[model samples]
Target: MALSCGIDFGTSNSSVAIVKDGTVGLVPVEGDHVTTPSAIFFQRPNNTVYFGREAVQMFFDRAGGRFMRSLKRVLGTPLMTQGTLVNTRHMQFGKIIAAFLQNLKTQTDVFAQHDVLNVVMGRPVHFVDNDAEADRRAQEELKAIAQSVGFRNVEFQFEPIAAAFAHEVNIQGEKLAIVADLGGGTSDFTVIRLSNRYLRKADRAADILASTGVRIGGNDFDKDLSLSIIMPEIGYRSTYGEKHLEVPLHTFHQLAEWSKVNFTYTPKVIMQTRQILHQSHDRKRYKRLLQVLEQETGHTLLGAAEQAKISLTGQAEHRAAFGFIEDDFFVNIQRREFDDAIQYEVDKITASATQCLNQASVRREDIDLVILTGGTTEVPLVQEEFRRMFPKAAIADENKLSSVGLGLAYDSQNKFGDGQP
Candidate 1:
């Protein structure tokens, strides 16, 4: 017999799900964890590769190696075609992605003895935001990668719609559901008509009303927070000239951003920073920035920023200590500060949700249920925004992390039933 499963290749994490014994179940991707961090760590000395949690640990523990996360964000961009040096070996980003998915296939094969070929891959509503051509190309790139990794019959499903299908499984009555899938790189929203009556249908095209997405998510919040709270200590807004000319900000922005961190490690950027520091009025902060670059602690700094962002979601205040840059170097961040930093992203997400409803010709009150998925939805402000938008609707977060994968599994079952080997 052949096995068909759902793959949610998220920006920050990844998961696989399948319908086993007539029930949708999450298949552990790494060490009994259904959702695994989307990270790849290469050990230079042994030329070994690690995935998920082990990969993250290797990244933090190893001395010199390449650690890549947020790989999905490179899709449809020029970076996808560019190769990078990992352990002195040149590897294309596409091949790295394929290797990761192939590893996922190997892991799935361990517990699932069947020859798995059919797959339903979850994707954001708009991979490249408003650019339809780029978005289409992104899907094509992913499909090619899936095919290269042994998935023979590949199908695509909107991530938000997949989450909605997961929620629809237990819903008894009819509902006009809005799914908010806030992943690491994108925020997607979908309005759908679902019910026990529609659950039995083979296709759900008619049930889906509108889908909208934007290139704003958890990473944006992390970047904004880093710029606001962390960058100032390292000369982000400091002066350089007799006229009090502000220091250049492009390099600092790149340093604060996760995807751009690697790009900032080049010789050109280092030289530019040195030139700025030599003439900087705020020499202390620029020296700190120079040390950060020399130490290659960009990932560590971004990690601190991400932790602070996560901490602020539940608590009023959080302190991020950057001992890697300087002993006793730290910054205290509050929830309000976080909110202020990420207000632009949150506002865009809200606007996207409103656009989804408007596109569906539905009123906010008409939305009977709001289903939240993806890890970023854990943020308190996002939750409050949903509540404010649909005060009457019941907000559901039952499948916050696994909804897309589970829904894709449900979709796979509906589409392939028992797939052919």
Candidate 2:
């Protein structure tokens, strides 16, 4: 049997899937969850380490360790060139990513009872939109990590294209479909033609008509929601000193975001925050910000915001209570409030989808199906955009979380099993 697996090293979650007996399926990475949160924590005292759920749980347990999430966001950026210090040990973003990929390989190997050396990795349409060199650099960085983890043969597939292949299996007739992949850190779109007949053909280059993406996704939503709703309670807009100058907002901005949270932990930033706290008019709010810096609880606060965003998906309103940051600290966020906060992103996604059609020279009426993938598509606002854009098209509903991974597995089978690379 070919020991190949499809790896979706997503911004918020990661998963692995394999093709066996002509069937593609997901391999559980943590417990029964095929997709685990893409997070890691280096524990203190003895320097123990954890990945995925345990890593998140360890941080929540207040293990006094270094917690890093959205590690993928560092790729294709200057941050990858300069490593960050974790637990007093200097490590590059590539090394951290390799650690996570290595863990995925170990888990998949144990599940498959063999060494999986070949992989089909999924990537967004563009890691850094319009910058070909940066996008290429991101892929090279990811490919290097894959090789370091023992994947001797590695191939890349656009995440939305991979998803289309998964969706193709269910299509009975020829149709034009648009794939909207709203991931944690990027939103990708692909306009392609799919059919049972096309599935049997080995070549699909011509079928993929147009592809476009933007660096906007669920994480951005979390940031904006945090800024609009959560950050204000923590001294985001307060003034300081007799001059009535606005309090420094950079620290609050970093605190509201996950990828930038670690960067704010420097001594200079801490000292500056302390100075602001001492000179602040609203000591209570600045003190809360100080507590976040002191306790290293930025992740926990963002996690709460993320949870509130998720909860607002099903309910009319949700409350994010940050008792850890401050006693009786809470923010009641209504669905409309969350929608308004993230409308900018929602507009970008809408424009990207329309751009895909225009680039392909395919009219909106010509689209036969609109496929939604990735976790963020669950939001009502996101869904509403798709509905408005492709009002006449039939929507193929697949497992949003696993579609890309599952599709990559199918691509792996086509690449390795059929000897057609």
Candidate 3:
């Protein structure tokens, strides 16, 4: 028997799903966890690779090696073709991504007794916002990568549209839905009519009214929050030298950004941070920054920021611990501060959602349903934006983290379930 699955290679987390018989189901990518963090950690000595939670855990445990997350954000950028050091060996970003996907396939093969091949990968509406050429290249590169990983038949569906299909699984009648997939790397929106009547139809192009996305998501929020709160503590935008001029900000930006953290571990960056530490007004802050650079704890620092952002979703305040950066030193981040920090990103996401509806020429009131997908939607501010737009629409967050993968599986069933594998 042949096994086909849908791969949602997300920025913050990833999932794999398959359609067995007529029912769509999720694959346990991480020891029974349907979803796994999109992270990779390379252990030292042998440079063996680990994925998902284990990867994150190994990195945090100071298990000597390289750690990387948010690899999906590199697609469509020149960095996709660039090489970086994974331990002592240099590896291209594309290969790192392929290793991750290959792991997904290997795990699937284990589940299916070594019978898996065809795949439908879920992608954002726009991988590189505002640049058609880069976006096209991104999909091309991804397709090639997927094929390299033993996916004999590969296809793609816009993530928001995929979320719509997942929502359609338990829906009734007809609904004019605005599917908002606020993921880690990007936030995508689609205005589409969802109905059980069209489930069997292979072509949903007619039902898709509009699709639009912005290159902003949970990771961006993490960056903003880190810059606003955490980075400043670690000498970001701090003054140095005789003129009291602010220190160069290039290093700090990369340090706080989840995708760019590992890039800051170069020898050049370490020396640069050391030079900045020399003229520091307050040696303590830059001192820690230098330590972070030298110790290669940039990822851990950014993870603290990401955790702080997630904690703010359910609580009014969170203490962003930086004990790794220092001894028992942490910052109290209030919800209001987080909201203020990420206001710009939230506004841009809202604008994109409105733009999607405009591209469809559909009035906001007509969207009777708002299907929310991806972990970013759990944020209070992000959710509030969609609610403000579609006040009357029913908001559904069924399986926010796994909807895209599950929907892609349904899509695969339609596209590949013709009679034979």
Candidate 4:
């Protein structure tokens, strides 16, 4: 017997599902939670590792080690081949990905009472937008990682299309639906025709209209909030020297990036910051910057921005604190300011969704339903954009985090049945 399973290795969160005898199911990868945060923490001295919510909590609990989030965003880039020192040994990123996948596979094994081999993995529509070769390489690399982790066979499904499948099972009549899956690392869209007529069809190519995506996502919003409201207090725009020349801002930008934050503590960059600190006209701001680097608090500082972004999802203002940087350090962020900061990213996401419709020769009013998934859709500004576009279309209630995984289970059932390979 074979276990046909699906894995949505998302940017911010992840889930696993299986199709058994036409029934879909999930195993609690962490405690009672089917979905776990896509985070990893490595505890020092022993190099012991933790994943998901536990990893994040350990990170904030002052546990000694390295923390990494948004690992999915690094897949299509050069960093996928790079390595970082976990303890005394350098660990390649490909191995890191395998480790995470292996953990999930272990859970799948226990759920099946045997080794589960046939699997499907979800991928964003555009892993690296506008770069076809790079996109192909990214998919190949991911497939290799899954294979390395003991999967006998692996297949890929576009995330938004997978989400579309999850919605297709619920609708009755024929409808032109748009699926917008905005995750922590990318925003993806799919224009498709959904109906019960095609519910069990294995090939959805003729039903799907168009698929498009861009790399801007929730992490970008976190970065913008960090740079605009949090970085200034840490010498981002402060001046130095008799000329009062502005201090270099590249390091602050790096700190704002989830994938590059660790690079901020490199000896070369730290030395450069100190050289400028000596000439700072105002040492207070630069001192705070130094403190962040010395403590390797890049993730903690950005966590404040992320929390503020969530807090402002419904309110007008949020005061984010960075006591980790200094005692009583707080920054008040207005909703308008947060919206203004992310205006560029918002516009890009809007344009990508428009591109999908245009590619399919579909119009706003032509759509019958708008299926929204992924956590970033919770933001007020992002919600408003969709409302204005598909004013006449009804919004489908989506699972946000696990829809793709659930849909992929259906896909797995279609591609690989109940028999052993």
Query: How many collisions per candidate?
Result: 0, 0, 0, 0
The true-versus-predicted C-alpha distance at residue 133 of model 1, in Å, is: 1.4
Candidate 1 residue-wise lDDT, 73-158, digit = tens: 88998887787877778788899899889888887767577667889999998889768898998999999999999988999999
TM-score attained by model 4: 0.97
Error at 385, model 3, angstroms: 1.4
Query: Model 1 RMSD to the real structure?
Result: 1.4
Deviation of model 3 at 83, angstroms: 1.2
Runs with alpha carbons beyond 4 Å of true place in candidate 2: 418-421
Model 4, runs deviating above 4 Å: 418-421
Q: Which candidate's lDDT is highest? A: 3
Residue pairs in collision within model 2: none
For candidate 2, the TM-score is: 0.96
Q: Kindly give the stretch of ten consecutive residues in candidate 3 with the minimal lDDT sum.
A: 412-421
lDDT for position 242 in model 4 = 86
- Residue 246 CA displacement from its true place in model 4, Å: 2.2
Q: What are the TM-scores, per candidate, against the unseen true structure?
A: 0.97, 0.96, 0.97, 0.97
